[model samples]
Target: MLTATLCALLLVNLWTILRFREDKRRAVAGARRIPEADLLALALIGGTPGAFFARHRFRHKTRKQPFSTWLWLIAAIQAGALIGFGWPR
Candidate 1:
């Protein structure tokens, strides 16, 4: 169980990082953007850390109203849940 969880975390983080880099590329190339919902969904599913880092490192979506707010909110919730669920019995 722990192995699976850890694997998911790494994979999700990698995905988030790649997504951010791709988004930046498309933005500079004047191409279609990846959907915001897709990005948010990734964050909700254990990708929040990567998403947060990518946002700052790529300088994307930081100043966007409510988006940053939501990311932070999701991160906090995920952190709480992790603590709650992983608490020693």
Candidate 2:
């Protein structure tokens, strides 16, 4: 079960990274872009790490208002939950 869960998380993170990359590409091309809510939703799940990774790697949304705040909030909440609940054995 743990292995399966980890695998699923890995895939989600990868998808999240791809989404960020696509969004960046669209931004540069002045094309339709992925909604911010969708990106936040991804982070709200287990994609926080990937979100940050992609943000730094692609330099995307680094200074976006409210979005940066929301991302940090999500990361903080996730960290708190992990600390409170303890790790899965």
Candidate 3:
């Protein structure tokens, strides 16, 4: 069960990175973009690491106002939860 959960998280993070890449591509092309809510939702669900990585790698949404604030908040909450509960057995 633990292995399965870890695998799922890996997949989700990969997906989040892909989404960030796609969003960056669209931004450069001036095309329709991925919604901030969707990106934040991905980070909220154990993709915070991926989100931060993609933000640095793609230089996407780094300085965005509320988005950056919200992403940091999500990371803080996730960190708090991990600290409170400890690692899975």
Candidate 4:
């Protein structure tokens, strides 16, 4: 179970990072963009660490209002869950 979880996290992190890079490129070139929902879904699925880093690294979607709001909201929920349920006794 732990190994599977770690593998999922690693893959999602790489996926999120690539999405960030792609989205940034699209923004620069005026191409079709990845959806915000997709990015948020990636974060919610344990790729948040990567998403957080990508946000800063690419400077994409950092200052947006509701999107950033949702990202932080998801992060808060994840943290809360970890603390409340997953923390060691």
Flag regions of model 4 displaced more than 4 Å. Answer: none
Task: Tell me the tens digit of each residue's lDDT in model 1 across 6-42.
Answer: 8999999989989988988898999999988788889
Sliding window of 10 residues with minimal summed lDDT for model 4 = 80-89
Local distance difference test values of all predictions, in order: 0.88, 0.96, 0.96, 0.93
Residues 6-62, model 2: lDDT tens digits: 998999899999999999999999999999999999999999999999999999999
lDDT of 3 by residue, 14-45 (tens): 99999999999999999999999999999999
Worst 10 residues of 2 by lDDT: 80-89
- In candidate 1, stretches whose alpha carbon ends up further than 4 angstroms from where it belongs are 86-89
Candidate 3 Cα deviation (angstroms), residue 89: 7.4
- lDDT by residue for model 4 over 20-48, one digit each (tens)? 99999999999999999999999999889
TM agreement with the true structure for every prediction = 0.88, 0.96, 0.96, 0.93
RMSD of each: 1.7, 1.0, 1.1, 1.2
Clashing pairs in 1: none
